[model samples]
Target: MKVGFIQFSPILGKPTQTLERLEYLIDKGKHSDILVLPELCNSGYAFNSRQQALNSSESVADSKFIRFLHEKSNKYNLYIVSGFCEKSDKDLYNSSFLVGPNEYIEVYRKSHLFLNEKDFFSPGNTDYSVYDIGICKIGMLICFDWVFPEAWRILALKGADIICHPSNIVLPDLCQKTIPGHSICNRMFIVTANRIGTEDNLTFTGSSIICDPRGNILTQASDDQEEVMISDIDLNLARDKSITSRNHIFLDRRPDKYLDIAKAIEESV
Candidate 1:
């Protein structure tokens, strides 16, 4: 399958212009089987206040951005994963949605809030989940959740062939290193779509990447530019968790022995 990601800078409080730019990128990536966009691709990140975030948020069911994705997915016969500020009822969430040729597949709220996000968005209630997209079993996780190893492990355990990571990353080295680690350990493919440029003085690191199960970087973008990176991968390669003839990444796990890890970390905090 052909998987691709778009890296671009989103202007704050300008959803229309952002969507137009994203539409152009999506058009450029129409040949890809699956495409991903950066976190908060529509409304932009780095909100000045809670009211500003709320003002910029929209419901997934009625969002112009989502509606455009639906149309484009149907037109191109592609699957799309994108991040946006989601408004459900009165609460807001840092969320990403998976849309296929059929329509909406699933929405993943950001599980781990970062920095000032706690003041504007609610933590995701849904645990790590995977969905079937005909070609592969895909999982979704937003920015900041990459810091939690458990999130990646859970998705791996749930039979995820590919993990779609939509991010607005500030720390370049962390994601650049961690995403390959997640792919190598889980023995699954990882596609990370990160934004570029600055918002409210917070500059995003834009090294968007697609990594194979063996931790090889299939395609990577530049740190400071807007670009689309694409790669063709075999979904069957991720199905086997065995690292070698004697080692199996999943079968070798000792979950029973590591039960105290979370508790110990919580106590230390």
Candidate 2:
């Protein structure tokens, strides 16, 4: 499968201009079966206030951005996993969803909030979701969740072959370096789509990456470029969890000894 990421700076509060630019870029870029766009690519990240964040969010039920994605997916005959600032009822979530031809829309909200995001968005109440797109099982996780190994493992356990990460990252080189470890540990392909450029005082780090199940960096983007990075993937590699003759990443897990991981902070204390 041809999988990749679009790395670009999304102009905050200006969905029309941003989407237009994105459309143009995608039209000019190389073709791929699966494409991952940056976090909050439609509404943009780095909100100034809760009200602004709310105003910027689009309803999952009726959103122009979602329609745009579907149109593009159908137009290109591709699967798009994109980050969206979602308005569900009265709450706002840092969320991303998968859209494509002949597939029902599946949304995954960001379970972990970073820094000031807690002030503007609610912690996602949904469980991790992996969508089956006929060719492979795809998982979605937003920006901050990359730091949580458990999140990656959950998707791995659920039989996901690829984890598409939509991020507006600020931390330099941390997630990129750490993700290879995650790929090796989980034996899953990972596509990290990160945005470049600064929003207010925060300057995003845009080294978007794609890695194989064995932690091989297939393709990588620059730290400050608006580029599309693509790589050809053998989907079968991710389906196997065996490390050697006697070892397996999943079958050898000692879940019984890790019970304290699920306990609340106070209970653990």
Candidate 3:
């Protein structure tokens, strides 16, 4: 399967302009089977107040941006994963949606809110899950979720072939160094779609990348550029989790000994 991501600077508070940019990028990525965009691609990040975040948030069912995405999906015959501010049941959440040619596949809320996000957005209620996208079993995760190794591990254990990561990254080289490790540890493919340019006082790091199951960077974008990076990946590589003839990544786990790890982390939190 060919996977790709668009790395672009989104103008703050301009959904119309941002959608236009996204549409253009989508058109450019027609050859890819799956295309991903940065987190909050519709509404830019860095809201000053709760009211501003509320004003930008929209229900997925009623969102014009989502309708546009559906149309693009049908027209291009590709699966798209893009981030947006979702409003549901009078609450707002930083979310990403996976849209196919005919219908919405899944909605993944950013489970680990970063910095000021907790002030305006509710924490994700959905657990880490994978979907059968015909070509592969795909999983979705947002920006800050990358920090949690458990999140990626859960997805891998669920038999995810590819993990789509939509991020509006601001901290320097954190994602660049962290993502490959997750792919290596889990023996799964990872596609990170990160944004570029500065918003308010935050400077986005646009090193969007696609890594193979063995942790090799297949393709990556520049730190400060609007780009569309595409790479053809073999899904079979992810399905086979064996590191060597004698060891398998998943079967070799020592879960019995680390059973208290989750409880320990929860207590710390």
How close to the true structure is residue 113 of candidate 3, measured as C-alpha lDDT? 97
lDDT of 1 by residue, 1-269 (tens): 89999999987889888877877888999999899999987789999998999999999878998999999999999999999899999899999999998775689999999999999999988778899887889999998999999899999999999999999999867888888899999989999999999888798989999999989999999999999878999988899888789989878888899877768566867
TM per prediction: 0.97, 0.97, 0.97
Scored by lDDT, model 3 comes in at 0.91
Whole-model lDDT per candidate: 0.90, 0.91, 0.91
lDDT for model 1 comes to: 0.90
Pairs that collide in candidate 2 are none
lDDT of 2 by residue, 13-105 (tens): 999988888897776543888999999988888888989998889998898988988888888888888999999988999999999975458
Worst 10 residues of 1 by lDDT: 259-268
For model 2, state the Cα shift of residue 27 in Å.
1.8
Candidate 3 lDDT, 6-39, residue by residue in tens: 9998777788888888778889998999999899
Ten residues in sequence with the least summed lDDT for candidate 3: 259-268
Residue 259 alpha-carbon offset, candidate 2, angstroms: 1.0
